[model samples]
Target: MSRFTTACIVGGLAAASAFASTPAQAGYYILRWDNTGICQVWSEAFTFKPIRWPSGYKIVSRPVPTFNEAVNLQVRLRRQGRCTL
Candidate 1:
């Protein structure tokens, strides 16, 4: 094979790999503490895991795409008297 052919193959592979590898999720979750009934917007992408998280909190909403959206939902929940201080 010629040097030019090898370079083309290498470049193509690099581009393919770059496209195939996706970044981590940027979703957010809304959590409400059982003890306090206070809601919060969790920024971590992962869902509720008892082993990973402390007790007394439960996931109230599905994963939201942005932090602002999550906070809006939280505020709505509070207005409905679901999340109290």
Candidate 2:
């Protein structure tokens, strides 16, 4: 094949690979409140900004790759005393 045609094919493959390999966006989060055993919240938002909570209520924010993982982590955190249910 001509050099120009070969170059175009290579460049096109590179571009396609780059686009296909784009990283996933942040989407899963687990929110747990301190002092309340088994109190937890799940979110799909990229950011967590809690505005208010009862006194002594601590917010534990965990970013996870999947919803199931986030829920499992919340359970673990509750067991570990990092956050309540």
Candidate 3:
């Protein structure tokens, strides 16, 4: 690729990264399927509650990258004996 094209791509990526880093208002907890257990969820909306979880669950911010990360967070929270709904 030409130098100009490369520069534009890099610049665009930088701008996107900066925007992604900017903080936004917190949203309500939304539940997705926890494959670590036995649930196969089709929807990705948690009922708007005060965000409660069992001893092994954690209520993390929504929009996690992957299902595995969500499950890991849940497991960690459960390990800590904290409610993470």
Superposed model 3: Cα runs more than 4 Å off: 1-62
lDDT of each: 0.83, 0.66, 0.49
Off by over 4 Å in 2: 1-25, 34-39, 46-49, 53-61
Against the true structure, what is each candidate's TM-score? 0.61, 0.44, 0.29
Model 2 RMSD, rounded to 1 decimal: 5.5
The TM-score measured for candidate 1 stands at 0.61
Candidate 1 global lDDT? 0.83
Q: For residues 1-85, write the lDDT of model 1, one tens digit per residue.
A: 9999999999999999998897766888888888778888887755545442455788999988888899899999999998994
- Sliding window of 10 residues with minimal summed lDDT for model 2: 51-60
Best by lDDT: 1
lDDT of 3: 0.49
Hey, what RMSD does candidate 3 come out at?
9.7
**Per-residue alpha-carbon lDDT of candidate 3 for residues 1-85, written as tens digits (9 for 90 to 100):** 9999999999999999999998653333324323233222111444344333442323344545556666665566556644333
Worst 10 residues of 1 by lDDT: 46-55
Better of 1 and 3 by TM-score: 1
Kindly provide the TM-score of model 2 when superposed on the true structure, using C-alpha atoms. Answer: 0.44
